[model samples]
Target: MNIKPLFDRVVVESVQSEEKTKSGFILPSSAQEKPQTARVVAVGPGGVVDGKDVTMEVKIGDVVLYAKYSGSEFKVDGKEFTILRQSDILAIVE
Candidate 1:
């Protein structure tokens, strides 16, 4: 499905939580916390800042880390996604 965000909004697909810890300890789905990292799926062209177009620092396919409580959640085609402003993103992963 194609998704286009508007005015600085970004669509992200959250990375799935790990089923096991680094030490090999298994974790149930209910015991896992939602992952705060995600990949950028779609992005708005730009946002108006003092009437000028300000482009986003991130682009589609960029993996980024964000605050745990950031963004609003929704589903598209039965898949979950998050809509967050650029400011909510903390850092881009290499």
Candidate 2:
């Protein structure tokens, strides 16, 4: 399955969460926090959107940090993904 965003939208997948804490305490699945970081899966063409000339700052394969509870989540081929606007992406990880 191919996911292509439109008009400054971005598709990303959550990075894996830590199973153990730095103190060597193991965390269970229910205790794990949601991952704020994700890898870019696909990007939309930056055309005019919402009366603004949007230029895409993110590209495919970029790692990014987003709001804790942003975007819509879906699954494709048993893999999870999130779709959000470019503005929702906070920063790109170098």
Candidate 3:
């Protein structure tokens, strides 16, 4: 299935978090932190939003960082994804 966002909304899939720490200590799933990074799946067209002009800075396949508890999460075709406004995305990963 394909996802298409609208009105400055973006669809992103969460990147898998590392199971081991930098020190080589393995962490259990319950103890691992939720990943804040995600890969852009779909991007909305930039336009006026909330009485202001909004421009999308990220594109599909771009990796980005977002707020810890922002956006709405859902699943499609057994794959999990998050949909959020472009402003909700903090920074695009280089």
Best by lDDT: 2
Q: What's the residue-level lDDT of 84 in candidate 1? A: 92
Tell me how candidate 3 scores on lDDT: 0.92
In angstroms, the error of model 1 at 20 is 0.8
The lDDT, on a scale of 0 to 1, for candidate 2 is: 0.94
Residue 15, candidate 2: alpha-carbon lDDT: 88
For residue 10, model 1's alpha carbon misses the true position, in angstroms, by: 0.6
Flag regions of model 3 displaced more than 4 Å.
Answer: none
lDDT of candidate 2 over 1-94, digit per residue (tens): 7887888999999989889999999999899988999999999999899899999999999999999889999999999999999999999999
Please, what are the lDDT tens digits per residue for candidate 3 over residues 2-38?
A: 7778889999999999999999999999998878999
TM-score of each: 0.89, 0.96, 0.92
Candidate 3 pairs with clashing backbones: none
- Which scores greater on TM-score, model 1 or model 3? 3
Query: How high is the lDDT of residue 44 in model 3?
Result: 90
Compared with the true structure, all predictions reach lDDT values of 0.91, 0.94, 0.92
Number of the predicted model whose TM-score against the real structure is largest: 2
Model 2 residue 17 CA deviation in Å: 1.9
Error of 1 at 44 (Å): 0.4
Error of 2 at 69 (Å): 1.2
